[model samples]
Target chain A: MSDMSRPGVIHDLGYRHYDGLREGTPAIARTLFVTGLRHVYGLGRSGKSKVMPFLLLAMSVLPALIVVGVVVLTGLDSLPVSYADYTNQTQLLVSLFAAAQAPVLFSRDLRHRSIVLYLARPLSAPVFAVMRWLSLTVALWLFMAVPTLMLFIGAMLSGLDKSDQVTQLLKAVVLQTLLALLIAGITGLISSVSLRRGFAVVGSVMALIVLTGVVTAVQAIAAEQDADSASTTAGLFSPWSLYSGLANAWDAGIDTFVPVDGAWAVAYALVALLLAAACLLALVARFRKVGSR
Target chain B: MAVVTGERTGQAPVITTAGLTKHYGSVHALTDLTVDVGEGVTGLVGANGAGKSTLIKILLGLLEPTGGHARVLGHDIEHESQEIRRLVGYMPEHDCLPPDVSASDFVVHMARMSGLGASAARERSADVLRHVGLDEERYRPMGGYSTGMKQRAKLAQALAHDPRLVFLDEPTNGLDPAARNDMLRLVERIGSDFGIAVLVTSHLLGELEQVSDHVIVLDGGHLLRSSATGDFLQRTGSLLVEVVGTETERDRLGEALAQRGLVCRPRGAMVAIDPPPSELAQEGAAHDLIRDVAAELGLGLMRLQPDRGHLEDVFLDGAPRV
Candidate 1:
């Protein structure tokens, strides 16, 4: 072959050999988790993706801002809203955030058929599923916690009694974190199975929000008929009811959407944990099939 | 880069499979297949449903085989699949890119997943993207890229980790002829210049004939033939002769050559002359006879070339049984 007619030039683009340690499974999982987190918040995505998550987060915090404003202007010795009640009040925004963002973490990959790329890496199917769930859980926690944190800060700056309020607020934030995990788990599971983003969003909202209303209504009807056991058992069908039941049972002062008494509160806590675990198991099982369309 | 020479030493095969099989319920995607692939560019030629993707996924440890076993780069496909994946790069057969992520970011993330450090991953991503002939467009989101550009971006990510081997499944799919040629040349360079073993697949049999050192033909999930590219393209015992004139000259040569005791037939504007039997043949005897006959008949001999076999011949010849 003659080379004179075809002029060629080589430019070094600094393609270097990687002699550093090739981290193992944990590192791969961590990278996916971080990537999933960024994806949920639309950090690397287009401008349209940034809309839903930011809007939901702002909606979640807006009421807390108003409460703080009212307290600061009126100089109330005690905060008007209780810490635990704050999450319950903004539960709708938190649920909406989960419905919108869970699909971003789970459904987009399957819809684009990009899950194959992730599975071909060193990470296993279970690890990938767990990491995505964890990322969404953390994001949901931040969405709920930010508003609660704002209220806590407002109370502290307004010279309210720091000791009791801080203790109660910390408990409430922990409860909110648990609730976020429960919501993320359920929505993540739904998103994984529903390959279409629109379907996943609708399904998640229905599972997390609409079902709560239906279950609460059923519980109220059951209580009106004096069927106490059926009323308490009906609350188990809705995660919001279960969370409220547990929080209210722990402290009688905390107002809950659904009143849970006696050992049913313990059952509610156990069922919530079990539901999260079940969702995780379903996600792992879905990914383990090896070929996901 | 040092090639990781596993248990095998001299002339070791890069991939070896024995009785590998896969089935999806009643549909048997791959039957019992056994083959050994050596270093360099090996083309896997098959129809769309010939289980090419199934075999690649099995080798990468992404899909479990229904029966038999295989190994890539001396690692067991079943047990050491993670090891196989860590060392082998894969460009899937389908569109698997995230539309929202830029090529640079996606490739870097893939490199990191392959265990490259942050700086190394970024540098490797840039280098591979450039090597694949991607320029400033690499920074743009992949959704807007043309099919050729998307294929190149996929190739760039597959090479970002600089593995010892790579499985490129239909890298030239959906590309125009010019772009296909460019992609084939890049594939050839990856094997030759980078010293990385490549197992590339394609449905177009003619496309791999140029770039592949070895070719494997699969039919209905069964191994039809596996051999060196030269073996598949060995010269048949025939010669094609083209004359200066059109059909008239070609028929004249065919008749004249037939009279000389050579089996001759007109193929388009050319006459295909079967080689003379060994008992009546000598070196250049056929050539001399053709020239003499053409000269006597006042016909100009334009071309006298041996009829070469093609990769498609394997499928065409085996089509009856299949």
Candidate 2:
């Protein structure tokens, strides 16, 4: 009976066939989607351990918002006010939004070596790259979108309206969301290439805030030195500077100090898009190399 | 490609790899490894960083080799890894249990991922888990499990998919001795009872002597030796002799044997001697020499026997002394 019991158990598992490759496109796509969803829910349902930088972001912006609010609330009529001025302050919020969301979205998988588990099943590197980038871009857009909308509401209600008020407000929110996604995607791609999460985050923040700022300052000086030439907006190739150009466009004119328009803005978006794609492809290539090793 | 439904028809090995090499930058994890593992239980013995894990990973298609190729169950591992993964069961070297998932749920999910239907997956998972000795505790989160239970859970997951080839990578790594024995026995049954091809790896070489049909020794990511278990334990032609009467009698017998020009060494109460090959030609003379030597010194012969090499000796010789 003991012998009988033994074979009975082995027989029950039946048989498995794994000699042939599974090449069905539908099956591959389904597996990729399911795995991507698993990653999304895995991070989201990781409970309260999900690092919420919203609080830290609010604290950082609170001081600047208070300064703006004090002047507005006290009816300080002599204080400077315009849509362009509001856009500049909101630019700080955009930078803060980029700083908060990019690291958590990109670096968490690499930090945990969870990429090994994810890639081992069925998904390859390119599918993984596209899925993860889309997940992060969508999550970042949501995180940055709702708050920016609320701020837009607050701005509109703050007794500021012109003939192009509605169009400008809608355009501002749409451009801000697109710009946030572009920045998040670029940073996410960059961060995935780095080994440590903290270093990646620090590097991305510096790239967005410092390097891009320096480039835009250099361009501004160049445009001033050669006033005859079209405004030197070449620095807009950086996503942060590209968004700055978007704000300039929203103002219906350049800051004069930093002229931008015509083919220059298109060239900026083209370069940023190309860099974002190239970084994404590099991320895919990196994963293949790491996993193959 | 058509699925070959029954057992393998040819005498070809289930796994064969040639010139398998893996390098982690400058560190050669596996170097110039060539092995052909037949059906049944084969034990891979090595110390840490001895390339046991690297070979297993290469076989499982989780790693791509730098120099060579491995075929599992007649499938090319480099080009057809997904298929290899489907046919082979792999228990990883590390503790990688998802904390929130129960053992049963995780194993069932794995079975399904290997292409089982819902009912088959559930039924197989339960049966495999039960066979592994996990009880109601299996329903609990694996995060709180003891090392033995966790090891069993990992083993169960590997078997749940009904794989033809299973790579048990240090399955008994953290288990207590009893648990280790149980896991080893389970591994033995997987080969003998189920007709599965099992390649189990361990740093502890001697423990696999009884269960393994073949033993493969790996050192510094290279194959040192591979042989049948019996071949590993064959006699080495030396014999141990022990005579009991009095301590003086035993020593005098030893002295007399040495005076006779026999090469003998005092080993505890027993004096071991290497029999002259000419004396070995006649069994009676060899026996008489031992008895005569003891009697000449008025010692009573208690025991005299040929020394058979043990699996430990094989490992000792093959293992890197450093």
Candidate number achieving the greatest DockQ relative to the actual structure: 1
The CA lDDT of each predicted structure is 0.85, 0.67
Candidate 2 chain A, run of 10 with poorest lDDT: A14-23
User: Residue by residue across B1-322, what tens digits does model 1's lDDT show?
Assistant: 1122222347879898988999989888888888888888999999999889888988988877899889899999889888888888889878988888899999999999888888889988988998899999999999999999999998988888888899999999999999999999999988887888999999999989999888888888888888888888888979999989878778888888887799988878889887787854887899888999999999888899999899989988866223
Question: Which pairs in model 1 have colliding backbones?
Answer: none
RMSD for each model, in Å, please?
A: 4.2, 8.0
Comparing to the true complex, what docking class would candidate 1 get? medium
Give the alpha carbon lDDT tens digit for every residue of A130-189 in model 1. 998999999988887888889988998889998988787877877877787889889998
Docking class of 2: incorrect
TM-score of chain A of each: 0.91, 0.67
Taking all chains together, each candidate's TM-score versus the true structure is 0.92, 0.68
In the order shown, the candidates' DockQ scores are 0.56, 0.11
Q: So what's the TM-score on candidate 1?
A: 0.92
> Model 1 captures what fraction of native contacts?
0.59
lDDT over C-alpha atoms for residue B138 of model 2: 81
Task: Indicate the residue-level lDDT of B149 in model 2.
Answer: 90
